[model samples]
Target: MHRVLDILATEDGDVSEVVNRFRDIENTALRTAFHNCAVLLRMLEAQAGLTPTWEGGPGAETQQAVASNTKSTDSSPPTKNAPKRRFTPQELQPFVDETQRGKVSVAKVYVDGASRGNPGPAGIGVALFTMDGKKIAQISRAIGTTTNNAAEYTALIEALKLAKDLGIQQLYVLSDSQLMVNQMTGRYKVKHPQIAEFVAQAQELAKQFAKVSFHFIERENNRLADALSTAPIAKIPNQRTDSSSQELMALLDDNPDEGRTE
Candidate 1:
C-alpha cells in the first residue's frame, strides 16, 4: 500500500504501468494493497473535490466503491458547524510584537512547501539572501506528495545542500513554519511520525555546516518562497505557457546572487 501511495503521490508514470510493475506479487496481496491505497487516494481526491472515473478493469468495482464512500463522507460533513472564535487586535498585539522582534535580521533565507490536494502533488521552494539585503538564491522543484511538513523539510534540506555545494559556511535559515524551525533548532519536540525521518535528514545535513542558525519569520516576509511553492504546475502542449514562464522569470529575478563565485 505504501508503495502504491508513493507512486500515486508522484502522479507520474502510467497507471497501467504501475499495476503491471506490481504484477509479480501474489494476486490476492497485490489486489488488497492496491485497493487499500486506491481507497485512500480516492478519499484524498474527494477532499480536493475531484471525481475519479475508473474504467472497467480488475479493480474497477473497488474503485467505484471507494468513490461512493468518498461522496458519502463529503455529504455527511457538518450538519451543524462549530462556532468560530476571533482574536481582537489588542489581544494579538503581544504575539505580533514578538513576531516583529523575530523578524529583526539583516539577511533572511525564506523557504516554503506546497502540496496539491494535501497528500497529492507536492513541491518545495527556497530563497536565500545576505545581511546587506542582497538576493542570493531561489529554487523550486516538484517533489510529489507526502505531507506539508515533509515538503517543508525537503525544501530546507535542499537549501542546505545547495549552500554546501556553493561553499557557503555560515547561514541563517528562516522559514514561516515555526514547527520546522523549532524542531531543527532543538527547541521543540518532533512527535509526528511522518516528519521524524525528514527532521533527522535535516539534522544530519546541518552537521556539515560551519555555522547554521534557524529563525521563524512572518508569512508576509516569506512571500517569495510562498509564491514559488504555490505556483501551478505547467501543463504541456494544449494549455497556455506564458503564466509559468512569468513565474519562473519572477523567481529568477527575486535572487540575483545565485551561483555567484567568491
Candidate 2:
C-alpha cells in the first residue's frame, strides 16, 4: 500500500489515467485509498496552478463509481483476481541488482528441520546467503521419518555438504536449534548412537571448510529456512531410512571418528 502511494505521488504525466487504472480493484479498502490519494493529488495541483476547480477529465465517471462502491458496506470478500499495480521500468533494475548480490564466493548458511509427529515424516531446509545477506541457494527436502533432533542434525549435515559443493571456504552458520548448534560446537555430547554418526558426518564435512562458525539464532530471524523446512509432503520426494541418510551414517560408522575418540 505504501509503495502504491509513493508511485502515485511521484509519477509524472497523466496521473489521472494511472488513478483510473486502479479503480477496478475489488478490495474496497485499497480502491478507496487510491481514490482518496487521487483527490488529494488533484487538490495540490489546483493550488499550484491557481485553478478554480481541480480538473478530473473523461475518467471522472469511473472515479465516481469507485467512490460510490467504496461506501457499500456489503461484507463480500474481495475478488482474488483484483488488479495489482505493476512496478514501472524504473523499479525493475534495482530489484534485479539487489537479488544478484548473493552470487559471491563466501556465504552464511541457515538450516532448519521439521517433523510432522516427532518420529513421523520429516524434512530439512538449508539456505546460503552471501556476505551482503542475499540468498544464493536453498535446499528443502523430505528425509523420510525421523526424530526432531535427528532432523535438526540432518539439516546441519545437508548445509555443510552444500557448502562443500559450492567450494565455500568460510561459512557463518545459523540455526534456531540450540541443541544442534551446541552439538556441532562440541559443547554438548551426542548420546544417541544413530545421531552421533550423523553428527560425526557433519563435523567431517565442516572440516573441509577453511573456517566455519555456528550460532544459535531466534526462530523469527530464521523464517526463510523454517518455512522451507515444512515444505508440503507432496512437493518433496520421499526417501527411506535405508537410503542416503543411512548410507552416510554407515560410511561414518565405519571410521568411528577418523581413527580417534569424540
- By lDDT, the best candidate is 2
TM-score for each predicted model, relative to the true structure: 0.48, 0.51
What pairs collide in candidate 1? none
Clashes of each: 0, 0
Model 2 misses residue 31 by how many Å?
Answer: 59
lDDT of 2 by residue, 221-258 (tens): 56566766776343545545545665555444333233
Residue pairs in clash, model 2 = none
Off by over 4 Å in 2: 1-103, 234-262
RMSD of each: 20.6, 19.2
Best by TM-score: 2
Structural RMSD, model 2:
19.2
lDDT of 1 by residue, 1-262 (tens): 3344343332221243354355546778767877799789878856754333221121223434555455344542221121223323332221112222223222345688875544446777776554434445667667854456667888898888766655555566878777787678776666656567888888888798766778775564465676656553322122333456544543442232432332
The per-model lDDT (C-alpha) reads 0.56, 0.60
